[model samples]
Target: MSSTPTTFDVRADFPILSQTVHGTPLVYLDSGATSQKPQVVLDAEVDFLTRANSAVHRGAHTLAGEATELFEDARATVSGFLGARPEQLVWTSGATFALNLVAYAIGNATAGRGPSRFALAPGDEIVVTETEHHANLIPWQELAARTGAVLRSIPVRDDGTLDTDAAASLIGERTRVVAFTHVSNVLGIVNPVAELVALARTAGALTVLDACQSAPHLPFDFDALGVDLAAFSGHKMLGPYGVGGLLGRSDVLDDLPPFLTGGSMVTTVTLDEAHFLAAPQKFEAGTQPVSQAIGLAAAARYLEGLGMDAVHDRERTLERRMMAGLREIEGVRILGDASGVERVGIASFDVEGVHAHDVGQFLDDRGVAVRVGHHCAKPLHARFGLTASVRASTSVFTTDDEIDVFLDALAGVRPFFGVGA
Candidate 1:
């Protein structure tokens, strides 16, 4: 065996990458939306379902015991992936639910259910960024409305970077919560997480990080990042869909009430009163996604084998190549910090005159896959003075040839649409 760490092959492990689209070989570039699953991840779920299928943490049978062990082991693997403890991770449907879980739980606490640590009253402020995905934005928007707190935002600079000076001004003593994305799905730019976390800490405010984009592309250490809470999706990281994680400081979790309450999340219940379980269990109610959790654990193990530093280096190289090629194309304007700002392997952009949907369709016709439109980030789009844009994001499996094909297809979009030279 070679002493060097094994580098993953972009083409061999993923079966879907072998197929064709419209009689041409497929070049999948839309991993920002959802990544294609590897054979191992698929096999893990199938293996669990075929042998140990049962309700977890609520049954006494042999299958149940096996399922429970797998489920808890997944929790441990995922926690290790994010530099968190197993007990600090809460299972949710996806990042959307994880974020909403935080918002609603804070709202629950505000409604006089728990300690004031998670509560928000009138005149308190919630700060987010102008570049946040709707998943990160709308929850805090509703939270402000629910708690009579004010909603403020950090401004986006011309290059799609956050204005830290503006953030310093916006996040003051009255700021109850400072929620921001670790990376912009649209801009592909990494935010200043440590700086923001420090500011929030100084203000005595809670910090919520949207880590959906970062966890897959970067080396993440949630505890070291020093945020009060964070959320990420499993599917985006090459795991099974319908499973994600919400990680929080134990004290914060203990302070907030449960967002969804029912079976398996409580200690005792009477007709008029109910006692809930501890931090994670209190947050996870009803039947959980057992097979998906097992598959996510498999994905975590796979990523660990690859080593996150190696993964980040590979994706960043591909991203730089992608940006350079896109910049060479006439009338193709890469959005957000195109001057090689620190970013992941994501690139969203607008053509000179053609609409983004048309560009996406043209790319699709050429056997290239990419995401189009606002990407659930309307405010960021409006800031760029457009309603939509084309996005091509990369994964560890993306290749040099694939990126070259995408660039060739993109170069033809404007001319095909009869746009300016």
Candidate 2:
């Protein structure tokens, strides 16, 4: 594969893109939903299962030792990818579970199980943005309900960008926690993390970032971003399902109480009382996702080899091409404003006189797969006066030719439905 900034020849690494659908070459534009795994990631899981298939940190046998080493090594690799320490990252089922873990841990704190700084009192505010995915929004809603905290949101502008002035006003002395997404799944626009973090800091609020979209496409560093906590999913980053990570500062994790408690996380146990382990282990109870973590580490290595800067550049080129093409088509209303803002290679649009499902099916018939729905973000869609829209997202394996094919298939949607341009 070439190493140029504007070109990516890494499509061959993903075997799923080679097959035909409906007698046409498959053109997958739904990486924002979930990315296709490469051959190396698949091989990593199979190799670990075949060779070191023992429960980690359990028995003193050779297989157990090997399994434990491999598992911890996987943690180190993923932590390096995020520019975080291994001790600061905790494994969970996915981003949903990670966010819930933080919320529930804070709830525990409120119940007098941990530090008072994390505890919420009556009239305390939990702030979120209008563009948040439900994963980032609902947990806070539940947390606020459990505690006496109030829930508030910063509104989005008509162009789908966040209203930063409103955010500055909302994140004042009453704010306890501020959760937002690093990138919008619906609009693909990158949020202003530095500005938001500064606001939260000035107000003495905890900043929680949803990095599920940025981790796969950009050069991510949790330490550099200065967020108190962040969550990301492996499946969205060319790894397997059933695994994700929650990253936090060492002090923050040390202060958080355990969300899930059981075996593998206890230091000492009596008939009536038990002492828990440290963070990362305290949060990870029962059995862990072993082979899936190995596969995710392999996926991280693959991205590192390709260089994240080059990947971002190539995707930006594709995004510009996609936005330009969509703008030229009549009756295609894009969801967000693409003028003078940083974004990823994702475009959601609505076709005139046709349902989003029909548009998706039309593209699917031409072997172009896209996501069509509210995309688990009903609030963002409702903000735009839409219940659903068609979304096309790119990945490291996406090609210029594939983008062209997707744009051409989209241009034919209105014509096929007999809607006049």
Candidate 3:
């Protein structure tokens, strides 16, 4: 495979894209919600289940060994994809669980069982941005409430960019943890992660990132970013559902307590207490998502083979085209700063004189799939005086024709609703 896979080749690998919706060809533009999977990812999961099906790390049998090897190899593959070590990744159900693990572990530590380095006390603060998904926002909010720590947020500027100057001011010595999204799931704008991380470091605060919107689209080196921890989901990255990971600095994972405990995570168990395994294993309990992990590894490999620089460049062109198309449609106001800021291929907007749901149904009728509603970032929508908006996101498999179809469908929405000029 070359550094850049052609769009036709990429689209061919995804079987579902060949289908039709309401008698029109399916023009999928909702990659931000969850990406459609490729044949290789699907094949990987089935191959694992059919041949090497067994409990990982528990049995001494041959099948168990094969399963364990495949599972661990997947870990190594995914870790390498993120510029991390296998020891630094912990498997979870998805990004939501990954974020919860960090928050819950901090809460548990503050209750006096885990490391003091993670414990939060009164007057200590946790900072996040206004544009965070509820997955990132609520967990930290609950953590602060549980630990008596105050929660602070860096407000978003009018253009949908984060107010980094305000973040620098709010993240003082009292701030214990600083969490933010690498890209806004709603606004489609990229945040200044390095700047925010530097601010948090200057205040001696730990940093966490929600990378669910980034890992599949960009080449990520977590260690290079200088964050203490980050989480992302596999399903959003052309991988299977029900599996994701928490990638952290080894020192931080060593200090944090296990969020879940049961079989396989233990080294020794007395009648009263148990000794847990090392960092990655200590955090993974019960039967693991073996097939999902293997599939996700394949997805990572598929992305790497295509090369992230090429993926980013293709998506940048698509985003510019989509943005320009949206601007031509009167009353279709984009939700964020419509300037020369950087963003992924996510375009979210509100059409005047039409409810988001109505616009969404109109699009669906025309076989154009777009994400509607708050997108789990209600606070971000509330900032724009909107209860909801429509989002059309792109991926490596997205085509120019699909984008044009979406724009055409959007242009017809108002006229169909009898609200045209």
Candidate 4:
């Protein structure tokens, strides 16, 4: 909370942050939803569209060759950012698509379509954590429903950390997949990935990570984390929308069958039978998100230049400031245990006797934008005995002054609503 200068002073890179909302400068605290795009990301997409917009891997023409090189180069850049190789990455519309691809591919294998290791039988278990976002939860639910497998969850403690003992017991011989989030979107708690992965490995289960919240804030290295597969979104990491990646070990990706099959993914296609290509290409069907991929690579390079370690350090300071300020306010209860836990710059809290939407409106009127509702984390909200809460999340560009503005505005929520006065 000391007025020490921020480690990152790159707010000017994001053009949207310069704008006014409700006659006040915009204070964006909703990075958990989507980060505002920087000028470099915007320019990258436009540059591709203007100079090398063509169908990649389709033609022998000059534009197509240039586009294909840029697209594959983008894959390399993004994959390298996460400690993965280019062949280990598959492009998708977003993290939702990536997660679904893994689930459906496993379902296909269960249906006698792919490798035996991925096949799940009735009574087999797919374990997830209670703090999962619906994007990570619902897909596994549907996969279980389709394959007659059992869906189980590791409960969160009252302090919002996962019960590791519960996780150890839940992932037993019956477990086929142990999917969890790297960071809880609602609570901002950084989960113990290595320990969970160890348990899954011991149980002979596949580890799938929802890295949407972690990849942007932490020093992320998928291979180093030892997860079998991971998913992340570009829009969540200062990049363009409509693009993300599914990263996996080479052997795992090679063993899984294609979830979506059509043109651009096939090696041979007859009227009756079709043969698909290798890992990354096999999963990528039809036209890809060409411009968005270019933009995302640019975004990755931008973060690389800033250094993820420095970014993490800066956000930690902001999180401390935000959390400490929230605790001092009467009638405000932070959703999770904020003490002695590693988290990003995110704090979700409920104001006593005030609806989260009303709180959102009060902040929005003052140009302090934050996220409200369950944040696609209904089960986590239910665990806290609430339906929704207000979440203020930060990014590299977020200033400490913005955090103060949000806290000052939030202090008056219950008073302005004529409650707890």
Q: Against the true structure, what is each candidate's TM-score?
A: 0.97, 0.98, 0.98, 0.98
Error of 2 at 80 (Å): 0.4
Candidate 1: residue 288 lDDT (0-100): 95
Candidate 1 regions exceeding 4 Å error are: 1-7, 338-340
Report how far off residue 279 is in candidate 1 (Å): 1.4
Task: Give the TM-score (vs. native) of candidate 3.
Answer: 0.98
Q: Of the pair 3 and 4, which is ahead by lDDT?
A: 4
What tens digits encode model 4's per-residue C-alpha lDDT throughout 184-294? 999999999999999999999999999999999988998899999999999999999999999999999999999998899999999999999998999999999999999
Error of 2 at 225 (Å): 0.2
Residue 236 error, candidate 2, Å: 0.3
* lDDT (CA) per prediction: 0.92, 0.94, 0.92, 0.95
Candidate 4 runs further than 4 Å off? 1-6
Residue 339 deviation, candidate 3, in Å?
1.8
Candidate number with the higher lDDT (1 or 4): 4
Give lDDT tens digits, candidate 2, residues 1-421.
Answer: 2355477678788999999999999999999999999999999999999999999879999999999999999999999998899998999888999999999999999999999999999999999999999999999999999998999999999888899999988999999999999999999999999999999999999999999999999889999999999999999999999999999999999999999999999999999998999988989899999999999999999999988888888888889889999999999999986588889998999998999999999999999999999999999999999999999999988888888999898999899999984
Name the 10 consecutive residues with the lowest summed lDDT in model 2.
Answer: 1-10
Task: List, residue by residue over 1-421, the lDDT tens digit for candidate 1.
Answer: 2334334675788889999999999999999999999899999999999999999987699999999999999999999999999999999999999999999989988988878777898999999999999999999999998889999999998889999999999999999999999999998999999899989999999999999999998999999999999999999999999999899998888878899989989999999999999989999999998999999999888888888888888888888889999889999888885564678999999999898999999999999999999999999999989999999999989988899999998999888888785
The sequence of per-residue lDDT tens digits that candidate 3 reaches over residues 1-421 is 2345335358889999999999999999999999999999999999999999999998899999999999999999999999899999999999999999999999989999898988999989999999999999999989988888999999998889888789888999899999999999988888899999898889889999999999998879999999999999999999999999999999999989988999989999999999999999999999899999999999999999988877887888788889999999978999894587888999899999999999999999989999999999999889899999999999998899888999988998888888856
Which candidate model has the greater lDDT, 2 or 4?
A: 4
